[model samples]
Target: MASSMLAPAVGDIAKEFRASDKAALAGQTSFVCMLGIGPLFLAPMSETFGRRKVFVVNSAMFTLLQIPTALSPNIASFIAFRALSGFFGSVGVANGGGSIFDMFDVHERAPVLGFYLTAPLVAPSIGPLLGSVIVRSLDWRWIFWCMCMLAAFVTTFIYFFLYETNPVAILQARKSELQKKHPDVEYEVEGASDESIPKKIMNASDLTCSPENGTRAVKILTTQPIVLILSSYQALIFASMYSLFATYTDIWSQPPYNFTTIQTGLAFLGPVVGFVTMSTLVILYIDSIYNYVARKNDDDGLPEYRLVFANIGAVLLPISLFMFGWTVEMGLAWPVPLVATVLFGASQVSIFNPVQTYYIDAYAKHAASALAAGAFLRSMIGGVVPLFVGQMCVFPSTSTRRF
Candidate 1:
C-alpha cells in the first residue's frame, strides 16, 4: 500500500515543483500503470526464480528504492524510481498464489487466495486514508519512509520461511545428485550437457517440468481463454475500486455530505469495512466449499469447480452496483450504500480467490504463463479507468443516468 501511494504522493510534490501535470501522477488508476505492471514482472519471475527469492529480493529493492526516491529532487527521477519500486513490489501479486501453494495443498487454497487478494483491494483505499493524515501534518516525503519501515517484516519472512516450492527444480536437484552418486543412472532429463556449474544451475532455474516438454511460454499465454475471462473480471472489479477512489473527494464533498478534506478521505472507511469483512468470509468458508465439492465428486476435482463460486459472485456485482447507486442517489440512509459496498467488497474477494486459485489449479505446470496472461490485462484495466472518474462523478450525464 505504501509503495503504491508513493508515486501519486510524489507527483503531488512534482506539481509544486512545476515538473509535470496531473497526467504524470499515473500510478494505480488502471491495470497498466507503473504499479500495475508490478504483477506482470512478478508472474514471469516467480516461474524462473521461485516465489520466495523473488519476494525477498524484490521487496528489499522496493523498500530501498524508497530511500533514493526520498531524495529525488526532480519529477522524472521520482517517477523512474517509483516505477522501479512498484515493479519490484509486485511480488505480492505475482507470487502470492505460489506462496499459498507452497504451504497448502489444493484442498486449502480457497481461503489463502482470499487472504492474498485483500491487500491489493485494501491498499489503494488505505494508502490514501493514512497518507492524507501524514501528508497533511507531516509531509509527502514520509510516505516513502513509512514504506521502508513496513517492508522489513515482508523481507524477513521471505528469508525465513518462503522456501523453494517449484516442483521441477526440486526434482532436478535430486536427479543431479543421483547421477553423480551412480554415474550410470539413466534418466530422460534434457540439457544433460557438460556445462559449467552456473549454466547447470541456470538450466534448473529455467524450470520446466521436464525438458522434452520444451515449448515457448509465449504460445501458452496467448491461447488461454480462461485467463482472458478471469483477467477481464479482475480488471473490471479493480477498475470499480480505483474509480471510486479517483474521485472520492468530489463525490462526497457535495451538498449532502459536505465532508472536509479529512472527512472525505475518511469516507473510505466504509469500503475498508467491505474489504476486511469479505476477506474474513473467504478465509473462513471458501475452502470448506472447495473440499465438499471435490469430495462429492470422488476427490477428482477439475479447476472448473472453483467457478461455481465465481458464477454467484458475478450475479452479485450488478445488484450491489444498482443498490449502491440507488440508495446514494435517493438520499436513503447512508448505511444502505455502506452496507452495499461491504457486500460488493465481499463479492469481489469471493470471486478473486476462486479465480486465482483455479488459475493455479488449471496450470500447475505453467502457472507463470497463466498468471502473467491475466496480470497483463487486469492491470491495464485497473490503471486506465481512474483517469476519468473525477469527471464521471460531476458529469450530469453519468451521475443522473438511471439503471
Candidate 2:
C-alpha cells in the first residue's frame, strides 16, 4: 500500500519540489529497492526467532517509519524515509510464504494461497486508486498518514490474535515452560533454547548474511533452474506492471483524457476489478484442478501441475500488454486501455499465484529464503524499470508500445 501511494502523487511531487519526472519517480524506485534488500536481513530473523514476533516488531517499525515520511521536509528526506518504510514493510513480503507453508499442507495451499497471495498483487493497483483519491482530496503527505493508520490497525490485530506458528519457536517456548516446572529433570532439547536479543541478532546475521548463506542464496539463484526461470518471469511481469502504475498519470492527466486526480486514481479500478474477478475464479477452482490433476497422476500431486494457470497467464499477459500498448499509442478510446489493464491484472494474478505455490511446494523447508531470492530479483527489476520509463516518455518510439 505504501508502494502504491506515490504513483498518483508523482506529478504533484514533481511540481512541489520542481523536480524532473525521473527525479520524482525515484521515490517509487528507491522504496522498491529497499523492499528487496531489507528482507535479506529481516527474514532470517523469523527463522531464528518466531514469525509472529518478527511480524509484530517489524510491523510496528514499519508503522512508525511512516510518520517521518509524512513529516519529511524535503524530497531527499522523503525518499530516504520512504526507503526505510519499504525496508520495514518487506517483513510480510519476505516471510509470508513461509508462514503459509507453516500453516497448511500442499493440497490445502492451492485455494488458500491463491487467496493469500492475491493481496500483494492487488495492493499495488489498489494503492494507486486510493492514492488518487487521497491526493485529489488532500495533500500528498496524507497518503503516508493514511498508510500509518492502516498499518497501526493491522499491527494491533496481529499482536492480539496472531500466535507463534513456527514449530521451532513453539517448541522452544514449551521447553522453557517444562524446564521451569520441573527443575529436577535436566531438559536439554537440541536447538530449542531462547537466546538474548543481541545473541539472536548476531547469530541470525551470521547464519543468513554471512558468506556461507549469502553464497547459498546466490547458489540457489544460479543452480536452481526453476528459481531462475520463475523469478525472472515474475521480475519481468512486476517490472511491466510497475511501469504502467508509475506512468498512467502521464497518459491520463493529459490531452485526450484530461482526467482529474481522482479520475486518474479511479482509473486503477479497472485493474483492481480484473484482479479480484480472476482471483475469485482461482479460489473457486484451483483446489479442484489440483485435486483432479493429482488423481490423474495416481493421487500424487506434482509441482508441475501448478503450471497450467501459468501457461494461461503467459498467453494472456502478452495479449493484454499488446492491447494496452497499441490502444494508448494509437489514440484509441480510453476504455479500451482500461479493459486491457483488467486483462493484465488478471494474467498477473494467474501467473503469480501458481508460480509461487509451485515454489513453496518445491522448496517447503526453505520457502522463506527461496521466496526472498525471488523477491530480491523481482523488486530489483521493479526498481530499475521505472527509472527508464521517464526516459521512454521523451521518445515515444522507445516506449512500452515498441514491445
Best by TM-score: 2
Q: For residue 152, give model 2's deviation from the true position in Å.
A: 1.0
The digit string of per-residue lDDT tens for model 1 on 101-160 reads 666777777676777778877776677777777776778778778877788777877788
Question: What tens digits encode model 2's per-residue C-alpha lDDT throughout 166-269?
Answer: 88888888887998999887766565545687876776666443532333454566689989989899999999989988888888876556788888888988
Q: Which regions of candidate 2 are displaced past 4 Å?
A: 190-197, 207-218, 394-403
Off by over 4 Å in 1: 3-14, 19-21, 29-32, 35-41, 170-218, 291-299, 328-333, 395-403
lDDT score, candidate 2, position 74: 74
Best by lDDT: 2
The lDDT of each candidate is 0.65, 0.82
Deviation of model 1 at 291, angstroms: 4.1
TM-score of each: 0.81, 0.93
Global CA lDDT computed for model 1: 0.65
Error of 1 at 396 (Å): 7.0
